[model samples]
Target chain A: MNKRELIRRTAIEIIAEEGYYNTKVQIIAEQAEIAVGTVYNYFSNKEEILNYIFKVEFDKRLDILKRLKVEAISFKEKLNLFLEEHFQELETNPATTSVLVQESQLPRKHSLKAVDDFINELPELLAEMIESAKKKKEIRDVNSSLIANAIFYTIRGMASKVVLNEHYNFDQTKEELMNLLWCGIKN
Target chain B: MNKRELIRRTAIEIIAEEGYYNTKVQIIAEQAEIAVGTVYNYFSNKEEILNYIFKVEFDKRLDILKRLKVEAISFKEKLNLFLEEHFQELETNPATTSVLVQESQLPRKHSLKAVDDFINELPELLAEMIESAKKKKEIRDVNSSLIANAIFYTIRGMASKVVLNEHYNFDQTKEELMNLLWCGIKN
Candidate 1:
């Protein structure tokens, strides 16, 4: 991995173990096997490192979603693919997922705006997908942004359950969520 | 009005303004116009103050839901009444709502377990409502816990939107959500 990625992975491990409030930049530097000054070369402080971690992960997901948007697949297929990939990513990186989910809820400090920007991108991407699906008549004419926000929070809530409750089965939960979104709760 | 309530209100103001990590016990004591020792007399520390804030707010909602459960109202009506009150509470106390929503996402710190317990109560209450509705054939026979979680997250997502985006209309969004839940999203 590159230096930036190395630093981030190290930070995620530490932050996940010691809550973000307890984590320090020097510790991350030591864990990454880099000098303290070298860490500064990439990230100015601990919050920036945290922000970078979220930004990198979110950017990767955005890239995949953008690519899927152009594919000649039905909206349902696209959504399923996205959900599957999203859950799989979380399952593999529980530590990072924990940090991202928890830290995003922190107060809107000016310092965390970069992280907030990255966090906000998910709903915007979901909104785009909904709008595209609406144009193609694949889904009902609903409020795309509202639906997007709902979908984003649904996934977030599921992720929180998966992380907090050991009994939560990721695959089964994903299938149930898809069914609810596609067919909904009403009989 | 009481001493504990005074401390909690003061903590909410500080925590809401400065975020949880940045707020100190001394500051909360000063704002509450009580001695630091007196603050500890009411609670152990800052975390307890925060937990009390959430517990007080959640208890009120849970009490209403429990009372509604025994009434002769339909499940849909119960659900609508519960949601209307929920949104109205958030609207009237945006600062406390912000703190509750944001702080609940913090890492699983032992100090915050009371807050976590209070936070988990909502989903459990929702699951009870869903299971009851299913028994009465008010809703479909589906995974009650999953649907409960979905509805909880949907409301959470809407709450976050109302708090973050200035243009979001709480009443209209609540209506859209009720429509989406009552009549499934499928066309």
Candidate 2:
């Protein structure tokens, strides 16, 4: 892995274990086998490193959501596809998923703009999908903005357990979440 | 109100405005117009003051859930009743509601047992409700424990908006959350 990727991977492991507040830049550098100054060259501060992780994750999801938006699929298909992509990542990258769940609320409290923007922007993208599906008369006329946010909340809450539970079957969770969210939009 | 009640209310207001970490015991006592010694007489420290607020709120919901448990209502009816009681309190006590939504995640990091217990136990109580309903065939057969946690997450996420939106129509929010959670448990 490259130096920047190494720093991020090490940071995720430490943050997942000790939490964001308990983590330090020096520790991340030592674990990454790099000089502390090299860590600074990549990230201005500890908060920025966390923000970078969020940005990287957010961009990936944004790309996925954008591609799904014009796939000519039904709303239900879109939801299932989106959730599968999301939960699969939680299974493969459990450490990063743990960081996302544990530190997500911190953005609301601590002004972590990348995390905040990711959480906020995601629902808007989902809302647009809901709105388009309603226009196509493929779904019920529930409040798009509200239901999108609720669906996002469900994903985060269930994903928390997926990370924390060693034997979690994420496919089951994805189905349950999809069923509940589909109810909000289905006629 | 009693001295403890006074401190609780005053702390909620300051914590809501400046956040829990930013607010101090002296600020709460000064705002309450009580001597610092008088404040300490009732609560041991700032952390305890917040815990006391959480305990009071948790007990209220616990009573509501317990009462609903024995009532001969359908699962849907029980959910409506519980949600009405919970959301109505948010309308009347947005400050405390704000504190609950904002500081709730702190317990996982900090040692605030009341808040932790409140969040943890509510799901178990709801899970019991779900299990009972499933046996009677009043609700769909699903993972009761997982769905219960998802329901609580919906309430907290929607309630966060209820506190932040000064002109929020909580009745609508309550209904939206109800519909989504009902979707989870309903056949």
Winner by lDDT: 2
lDDT of each: 0.78, 0.83
| Poorest lDDT segment (10 consecutive residues) of candidate 1 chain B | B103-112
| Model-by-model DockQ, in order | 0.34, 0.46
TM-score of each: 0.83, 0.93
Location of the lowest summed lDDT over 10 successive residues in candidate 1 chain A: A104-113
| Candidate 2 clash pair list | none
| Candidate 2 residue lDDT tens string, A1-187 | 9989999999999998888888999899999899999999988899899888888888889888999999988988998999999888778987888888776445345567786797789989999999999898888767788878878877877888766665457998888778777775677
Best candidate, DockQ-wise? 2
- Where does candidate 2 stray beyond 4 Å? A104-109, A166-168, B104-108, B166-168
- For residues B1-187, what per-residue lDDT tens digits would candidate 1 score against the true structure? 9888788888888888988888899988888788899998888877777778878887888888888888898888887898899889998997898897675455444546555565578778878887888888887766778777777878877887878787677887787677666554222
